[model samples]
Target: MSARLARARRLGALLLLAGTVQATPVHASADQPEFTVTGAPADRRDVITWGASADRMSNAVADRGYRLVVHTSVAGRDLRVRLSNAFGDRPVTFDSVYAGIQKAGAELVHGSNRPLTFDGARSVTVPAGGAVLTDPLPGRIPAATDLVVSIHSPDAAGPATGHWMAMQTSYATQGDHTAEEGADQWTEVLGSWFYLDAVTVRPLAGTGAVVALGDSITDGWQSSSDLNRRWPDYLARRLHAADADVQGVANEGISGNKILADGGGQSALKRLQRDVLSQSGVRTVFFFEGVNDIKAHTGVTAQDLIAGYRQVVERVHAAGKCVVGATVGPYKGWSEWDAAGEQVRQEVNAFIRDSGEFDAVTDLDHILRSPYDPERMLPALDSGDHLHPNDKGMQAMADAVDLNSLDCDSRSRTG
Candidate 1:
């Protein structure tokens, strides 16, 4: 089975393992750090280098430390990480947090590990459903480096919030060893991203970011794990080497997420503000979703899905940001696919290509579908299930995107 398909199934029972500790999200006391978000300035250059969307974690833990390794998309300085508790029923208090450059398994590059502060405080407490963006650390973070974030919470218990199906390797421990730069103490390998969701950096004044908003494909299910082969990762590399103003990339794809309703995660319509709009220095939204809704045989018409896409475009426009829509690719062999679903997919693709409602469009369906059978994915690009793409397909999708369209008229409302 492809990792893409397994990831979707993993979501159903994630809580079984993480189903441990924590109470409702809580506000910080005078001495306790609070969850506070000071959005990046409009005139400056703060861009997201790495991102993992938040989802409900049925499990919680106390006195546990996490060593999360994420690949940076854009090179910049003043690194910051946003810790999330967006799904916790109880408050979470992170007693220690550190960031560094990874050397070997669980080991940090010498002299790179540094402590992080939330508004000058060493510790922070996120409310039942809130997040805290850390004060920027002074230093330049190189693009494409394996950035590791170490975290420890003394009293995390209850339903927690985090990202499942990370498609990357992270580490965890039973105690607060966040300050250590060695690997001995961090032995447990974890697949999910806990607490932290977004990382940002300040690059050249004019440089910005493009957020790839979608499902498993964008999340990089079939792509090589721990190697950052997602379509967005490829896009980031392209942006970096090119002479474009948009250099940042955030993958906000959830495994089973849909555009119209909640299931895999919050519906795209629901998460746009928090995931897409809130990211620092985002210039365009690369919208690619709706396959889940279409395949489920829920009686969702192409018109219904189109309406959902329109809603997203309108909301993003209202925020003054540009949106680039991508045509949904073929998924003829997946279990739920039927004649009715194929028709819906065709109509949706037609609208994506012909409709000018989006600021711009990328014909992903055209690029990924088999010419001989438009309803089926090309064998070479298909990840076997016919719904998700392989590494080559991901690269094709990223390469298909026009670099100029990402800026959306010289970045109208982008941060």
Candidate 2:
């Protein structure tokens, strides 16, 4: 057998033979010793490189370490991570946290793993329904890098808070193995991120980010996993190539999430502060939700959804952030298709397109609908479910967004 294949097989075997591994402590470097900072300037804010909306966690496991792989959107220095226990009924303690560069599967780039400190402490306890951010690790983090955040949770319970559809493959292991940089101990594969929700980095002056708030489509349900083909991912690529102030992108999409009600996760209204406004260096909110509410047949009328949209717009404006609204795309072939839902969708889309409430609007309905059948999705764009879009469709959606609209200034808001 080839040496590489042989090594992979051996690794696979070790992964299946799960056992407790002693945690390795990450020592602070002599030159770059970990320190704490209080009341940092808001202008030196950290922009979110990777974020997943927290929801009730499933498959909770105690005394486990997670090595999550996330892609950064903007390049900058001073990296940090945010851990959430938003849905947990009890406090979750994360004893060890490390940030590093991924070299390969479950492996770290040599000398890249750095210990993360929270308020100058190595350990932190996140209370139920709360979250905390780590002190920035002093260094430069380039854009589009495969950043690995290793976290060891000693006492995790209740519904472990995490985003259900990560679309990325992370690693996990029993016990506290967070400090290890090698792939040998990180044997178990984890499809979901636990405790860790967001990673942020301080970027260039005037650089800001836009948070994409939506449901399954924005959550990247049909996009290929581990490839980062979500629409927001594509939009980030565009922002990097273009001359725009909004270069950072945070996807706060939750599958089955709604703008009006709470079901799949906290409603967009409830999560707005935690997911959008609370993030550092967020300048704009890209609102693209409401299809679930319209199709759920839950007696949600057009006015009800419109009122919800108004609330979102007003709240976002109150935070002094631009709001980019996207009309709901067509979804006719799905089982929930009905004339009443279609009518409500039309009314809502009309309001989204004609209303002057939003700072900017992207007609996703016009972009995704079939030319022949307005109520159905474009077959070429659909991912066969006639609901979610494929990678190409995701790109199309990203392309539909106006880069200039994302960077609106205060004068533009009033104008």
Candidate 3:
């Protein structure tokens, strides 16, 4: 059998492993992560990269039968799975990966006998330099399902595949004082060079998290890797401190996504369902996009861009979820940015600030614009490109968010 088929067959054996077939569809304890990967530098179709890791940390935990961290507090129900090879030269293989519940802080806890499968099979092999989707392994998880997924090499191979989602420096061992000496950084390459996409604990009962979607600015470009200082990461920390029931932030931002057209990725319209709507227990979405669209490739008009935002808002609201809009930051120095684009950006920002269509809105333009010269870019936030926000800038962006508008305490009416 082909590696992909072998992986598929392995998944078929999940039921034979010993465990009681408990009545399923019970709530998962927390939210699962929303992970996806695609190529960058706008318009490269054949060469693919994934959101993965270079070190085998996640692989070790999954292989040694360590429980996924999210299970400690996930809502049980139909859970979502996203396996990727957003950056790989060969087919990526996954062995037996399972998700379930365990006691809080249990590192080695393996919950239930349930395993992840794709298309009714056991193992799965993502195409060389491509991405794949897994079928939902339903009913196996309950409230607080502790996930333990084991990935073995079809042959010997590395774990992560794409650009590292870095904010601050990360250590190989969680809670260990040892530094992640000589670890790879994102700017060194464009894609995940073997990294963990993300892990989401299912929402407990009725709670989930909102994934802030966008580009490198959202990804925290130039932020200290593993510092957990990305705006989204910071927002997560703030939410946790507030004793809010938020599970965690699943950042799907790719570093160059535009709202209306495919540049760094399939346009917002193309990825909305997969990146935003499909998140488990998602009750709200904060839309922070369009800067690249208005200033970069698309050169879309202010009215057209506003219309695009409107479409996104409509779609989210149709799903019974709240939406928040973020104004685009100044990009006076972006390679493609010019006076004309700045004018359009100004128009769009005015609309975002004045528009009541969003459940809530944030003035990122106001926060990121240069105080010295309103038309000029903020030197601190500029990534030298005068386009993407630097670390402090991303943090500022994160700080700018009005968390209250997310409405975490409110219940979602799901279809």
Instruction: List model 1 lDDT by residue over 1-415, tens digit each.
Output: 2542443244223212111111223333232223334322222346788888888886788898999999998888999888888778888899899999999889999999999998788988877767777878999999899999999999999987788989999999999999999999999998999988888887765566788899988999889898888999999999888846677898999999999878998888777766776677776789999899998878899999999888888777765678999999898888888998888988998898889989999999999999999889999998888899999999999999999898554234334
TM-score of each: 0.89, 0.88, 0.62
333-413 per-residue lDDT for model 3 (tens digits): 566777888889889888888888887888888888899977656897776877676778877887787767764322232
Question: How accurate locally, in lDDT, is each candidate?
Answer: 0.81, 0.81, 0.52
Strongest candidate by lDDT: 1
Off by over 4 Å in 3: 1-81, 84-93, 98-198, 203-206, 408-415
Candidate 2 lDDT, tens digit per residue, 1-415?
Answer: 2542443343332222111010121122221112111222222346777788988877567898889999999888998788877788787888899999999989999999989987688998877767777777999999889999999987776688888888899998998887888999898887877777777787765567889999999999999998999999999999988746678899999999998888878889888877776677777889999999999999999999999999889877766678999999999999998999999999999999999999999999999999999999999999999889999999999999999888755323332
The TM-score, computed over Cα atoms with residue i paired to residue i, of candidate 2 is: 0.88
Q: Model 3, residue 233: displacement in angstroms?
A: 0.9
lDDT of 1: 0.81
RMSD of each: 10.2, 12.6, 13.1
